[model samples]
Target: MVDDTGQKQTPNTLEEPLDLNRLSLDEQIYVNMRNDREFQGRLHACDQHLNTILGDVEETVTTIEIDEETYGEMHTSTKWNTSMLFGQEDGFVLVAPSLRVG
Candidate 1:
């Protein structure tokens, strides 16, 4: 669509109902997995099964521990980046392109 000045505006993809394959096409997306792991990447390709090829991927793995003496919690997070990645559909918690992470 174009504005009054005749400049084209980016389509709001969110206006459409989202399904996995549609949302995965050429967008920045987040994939939450089992075991407290999350992946953020630009989705290049995907299928109905949710198996995907992602580029410029960042992976964050969170770990929590308790101290025996204080009974306090210790939380740790490790993050890494990769140029490209492939993911299986197994153990996927959610895949969202709209949600932003801190």
Candidate 2:
């Protein structure tokens, strides 16, 4: 296969889920974390345990509160930016398009 730039594309032979992170090195990626937290950043490094280091990160956290009287859920979203961050393996809920199952 060839990419848009006409460069030959290698087959995505991902033997393990962690291999996806390897392919995403130095590239933009989105990670969904526990507790309604989400992160978008450039992947700097990752380990076999799924722990990752990211740069130029944007983090978003969402919280839901129930109105006692109205019985309605109110959602609050908070966003912040950071130069770099380290993500622990267990904190990750989901990672982006790189990892897929057939």
Candidate 3:
């Protein structure tokens, strides 16, 4: 869903997880800010909640060992303004002034 600022909020789903491993460094940080509980019931509500769920973040990097031969990493820096929400589409849809994460 798109907000007043034209920012999009993508809903999360059980079948699909927010794969932090696929995200880049900047994206990870953005996820962190999005998933902050304190920011919930606010503009970044969905973002914060999802980070709490799927983003195994520490300091700046969220690591994933895909397999014995393959691994993935997500690193983040400063947070950015609410622009888009990336995740699965199942349970929720963006309803302005009342956002749901999962």
How would you encode candidate 2's per-residue C-alpha lDDT over 37-87 as one tens digit per residue?
999999999998888999999999999999999999999999999999999
User: What total of clashing residue pairs does each candidate reach?
Assistant: 0, 0, 6
Error of 3 at 28 (Å): 18
Query: Which ranges in model 1 have alpha carbons more than 4 Å from their true place?
Result: 1-20, 99-102
| Residue-level lDDT tens digits of model 3 in 15-100 | 23333322322333322232321111222223424432223323232333344455544443442233344443232332222222
- Output the better candidate (2/3) by TM-score: 2
Q: Ranking under TM-score, best-scoring first?
A: 2, 1, 3
RMSD of 2: 7.1
TM-scores of the models, in the order given = 0.73, 0.80, 0.15
Quote model 1's TM-score.
0.73
The local lDDT score (0 to 100) that residue 65 gets in candidate 3 is 36
Per residue, candidate 1 scores C-alpha lDDT tens digits across 1-102 of: 876688775654333344545755777988999989999999998876777888999999999999999999999999999999999989688888755458
